[model samples]
Target: MRILEVEHLSAWYPSGRTRRQVLEDVSFTLDRGQVLGLVGESGCGKTTLARAILGLHRACAGVVRHAFPRPQMVFQDPYGSLNPAHTLLWTLEEPLRAIGTGRKERRDRAMELLDRVGLGPEYAGRYPQELSGGQRQRAAIAAAVIARPALVVADEPVSALDVTVQRQILDLLAELKRDDSLSYLFISHDLNVVYQICDRILVMDKGRIVEENDTDTLFAAPKHPFTKKLLEAAE
Candidate 1:
């Protein structure tokens, strides 16, 4: 079933006096429990589209309709996204607390999520500064899902990590999707990683969707020149 429908969406940024288009008439649907990969180079408007969908961006027009719980984001840099003063437990519990989850339940859920994300009990009291990059990212992932969101917008979630850590985080995300029946708007320039996790792929070029297809078909025979270049670079 369709969980989201983004129709004729567009966004523009102020450019000196006039406006410059960043996203141009983009339209797509995300079904329930689907992982949709959005791949593009820098300045391709992938991020702008994601922000618009999350209601975090202005200067946009058109419709963004969804039939699901509120969406959350897992940012590229946990160091910057997470509050340094807050412990990982506090960070994870904040979401639950926002909707009137009791203190005891918040604590219990936080600890459970910490364990679920492969972080031990000892890590709970530690601040974001104390954890490694991978650990922080894991905590971030836990926080994003703590409120039982049906959809998540993960923008370059593993780009800053080591190769090994990237694989681990991807596997964690895959498992979470399976367990939670979650959908993802996974934004990244990394084609190989997208190929590994995404069921379908949308390729962006010059602020528009240049190509889209199922994972295997998109990789086997890319129709767009820009998509071909992306695959070649990934190889």
Candidate 2:
């Protein structure tokens, strides 16, 4: 089933009286359990697309239909995404509270989720400042997935972490895909990382998808000049 569908999506930001378009005519569909990697240069609207899909920003024009069960986002910054004032337990409880889960159920599930993300149950009682970057990112992912949403929008989720932590988070994402049948809208500038976890890829350039192909096909035979440049840059 199509978990999410976006067609002719465009997003713009007002820059000191000028409306600058960041994403132009963007279109894509995500199937259940499918990983569609959005790859491009720094200003290529990868993050903008994520925000548009999540309703964090209004699209200038187009259609974004998320098949019920909604979607959730796993932000890139572990430290920035979380609040230092809130305990890990409180952080985890926020979603449950918003979703109206029972108190006992929320507490019970929080512990289960902590373990699922490879963090100890005890860590839940600590604050975000007490954890490592990787630990915090894992916690973020845990919290995002704890609600069991059908889709996840991961925006540069491992970009700020060390290589080792990046691998760990990638592995966790892979494991989650296998275990839970989760669909992912994975956005990143790193072609190598995208290649590792993505089943399909959409190559963006200047707010447009210049090319797209299955992971292996795109890597093996990049047809577009922009895609070829991306491949060369990666090498």
Candidate 3:
């Protein structure tokens, strides 16, 4: 079943004298438990598409329909996205408070999520700056999932990390998908990483989906020139 559908999506940036169209006529449907990798070069509207899916940016013209609850994001920069002043507990609590989940429930849920992400209860009191890159990334993931979101928008989730940490986080994401049946819209420029986790791939260029196919098929028989260029770049 299709969990999310984006139809004829478009977005414009207001900075230019004539509003520049950053995304144009983007469309795709994602199935439940499926990971769709949005891959392209920089300035190709990859991040813009992610923001639109998460409702952070309004689409110029199109419909983004989700069959399930709203999606959550595991941002690229764990420390930057997280508050430096707040403890991990408080960082997790803000979302719960926003959604009106009770204090006690949020506290219990936060701790449990931390544990699930491979962090101990002791780390709850620590600040974001105190943790390593991987730990901080895991904390960010835990925070995103604490509310039990059905979909996750992971934007360059492991891009800044070392190869080892990236693999660990990718494994964690795979595990979460299996355990919770979560759907993912993972945005990244890295083809190798996309192949590692995504079931299907969507190739975006100039703010549009140029080609899409099952991960293996796309790698083995890419039809689009842009897709071929991307594969060549990866080599």
- Which candidate number has the best lDDT? 1
Kindly give the number of clashing pairs for every candidate.
0, 0, 0
| Clashing pairs for predicted structure model 1, backbone only | none
By TM-score, the better pick of 1 and 3 is 1
Cα RMSD to native, each candidate? 0.9, 1.1, 1.4
Off by over 4 Å in 3: none
* TM-score between candidate 2 and the true structure: 0.97
lDDT value for model 2: 0.90
Q: What's each prediction's TM-score?
A: 0.98, 0.97, 0.95
**CA lDDT of 77 in candidate 3?**
83
lDDT of each: 0.92, 0.90, 0.91
Query: Candidate 3: lDDT of 26?
Result: 93
Residues 1-235, model 1: lDDT tens digits? 8988999999999999999999999999999899999999988998899999999999999999978767999999878888988888889999998888999999998998899889988999999988889999999999999999989999999999999999999999999999999999999989988988999999999789989899999999999998989999999
lDDT per residue for candidate 2 within 1-235, as digits (tens), equals 9989999999999888789999999888889999999999998888889988888897478999999665889888888877899988888888889989999999988898898889978898898898999999998998888878889999999999999999999999999888889999999999989999999999999999989889999999999999999899899
Model 3, residue pairs in steric clash: none
What is the TM-score (0 to 1) of candidate 1? Answer: 0.98
Candidate 3 lDDT for residue 18: 77
Candidate 3 residue lDDT tens string, 54-83 = 789973779999887758998898768788
